[model samples]
Target: MYCNQPPEKPGNKKELLEKITNMARANSLWVTAYGTGCGAIELRPLHTSRFDMERFGIAMRPTPRQADVLIISGYLATKTLKRVIRVYEQMQDPKYIVALGSCTINGGMYFDSYNTLNVLDKYLPVDVYVMGCMPRPEAIIDGFSLLMQKIKDGRAQGWKHYKENLDYYRENQKKIITDWDLPDYNW
Candidate 1:
């Protein structure tokens, strides 16, 4: 059942196929980079020659529909959280979330701010969390690698959990996003 283990044969053919598919999906992660605050600047170096995230099969997608990963790269305001939730929902199933910077973890400097939410997991399930006010590109790359491993291990099931607990997530999102302008279902 371990991710690094080779797929078993015969009776476990279906399971073996699933494991192979997961490995392929994990290796080819198309990211939707949504930078909501100051940490957005750090992502710039990822595309440059120095970091070059593309080398790891991590490329940026123009739309959420085409992306397999959603990188929430900074502080999330109430207004922005609404949009973030919408975008996250729009992405296909088996998606992963990478929460970068201290802001998304515990609100960072905005911990006491009225418009910001301290913990991201309360509304959206986060698969990987890269700590620091603004994590370096190396840390971001590491986070992505960790996420890939999680996907391979079948531990990155946040999307499936969200679908099964839609009402609970919606209530938490609605509590902070008072305006509630979006429809009941994002799809």
Candidate 2:
């Protein structure tokens, strides 16, 4: 249920500049290479000739600080969830989260598990949920395209929402993460 239309053009110079900035951000997406579960396997083929994600301006980043998107692939264990939150917070503004697989949406096969999170949106605002047990590279690409469209339409504001509603998100995160030891986001 995300907006797909390009934003309405404004008359002012600031608005015009913002439109251009949004377009640029939409086109260039640097995804962090952090996969939490079995879905990580499918992500590898995206770089191959058949998939070639780079053609769409999607590249893998080594660190969260340099990445624009964090693709949480598969079920998130409680231990890994803590690190994921840390990495996610380190990313700069306009960041996005792509939940790959049914696990992220509803915990998939691990829905009843004690350690896995039942819903990802409670802790992190997910921009796109690439459905399937392990979504194919094509689906992942489609998800990326959708995310890009969201960026262009100014609908991908998960990071901003996180910042504004930090306490609400933190409460959800703390409920699942028992051994919380991460530093507060002061930026």
Candidate 3:
């Protein structure tokens, strides 16, 4: 009825298929490596042979459109927060955000800066928070694992939350990004 087809009723087959799909998505997570702030430096080793993120099926993609996971690391100034919102909007659905460091959660040392954002969650939905002054690669991997498990269990629904609460998020974003020029929908 909504599209050209009739509305399908809920059933066991649908649930089973959803579970299978979730498992597949959980394994094939593609991270968007956005260089937000000083925290970006700590993420360098994750791709090297020492960490080898691919072993866990997590690889960094160059663009937001191709990435499934966005890692917000370091202190986010208002300028960076604007770009982050734009990138987050560009990413396709079923996306997830992994916030790294105490800086991202509560602004860390940059808490007093008028230009830096104190709380990232006020602007975007964070699926996982890897807490540290600068979390170690092992801690980041552990965070990724937690995100994967959440994805597998079909609990990582930040994308849906973002879409549903678009107005609330937009207000928070606009408050920080005073010179808003981007369109409401990038796509």
Worst lDDT run of 10 residues, candidate 2, spans 1-10
C-alpha lDDT score of every prediction, in listed order:
0.85, 0.87, 0.86
Cα lDDT tens digits for candidate 1, 1-187: 1222332333565788889989999889998877777878999999999999888888999899999998888888888998898899788777889998998888899999998889999899999999987899999899988999998998898877776677788889989887888865554
Cα-based lDDT at residue 43, candidate 3: 91
Order of the predicted models by TM-score, top scorer first: 2, 3, 1
TM-score of each: 0.90, 0.91, 0.91
- Angstrom error of the Cα, residue 94, model 3: value is 0.7
Q: For residues 67-118, what per-residue lDDT tens digits would candidate 2 score against the true structure?
A: 9999899999988988899889888777999999999999899999988998
Task: Estimate, for each residue in 1-187, the C-alpha lDDT of model 3 and write its tens digit.
Answer: 1112333444886999989988989999998979887778889999899999999889899999999999998788888887888898888777999998988889888899888888889999999999998999999999999999999987998877776677788888888888999776453
In candidate 2, which residue ranges exceed 4 Å CA deviation?
A: 1-12
User: CA lDDT of 102 in candidate 1?
Assistant: 91
Query: Model 3 TM-score?
Result: 0.91
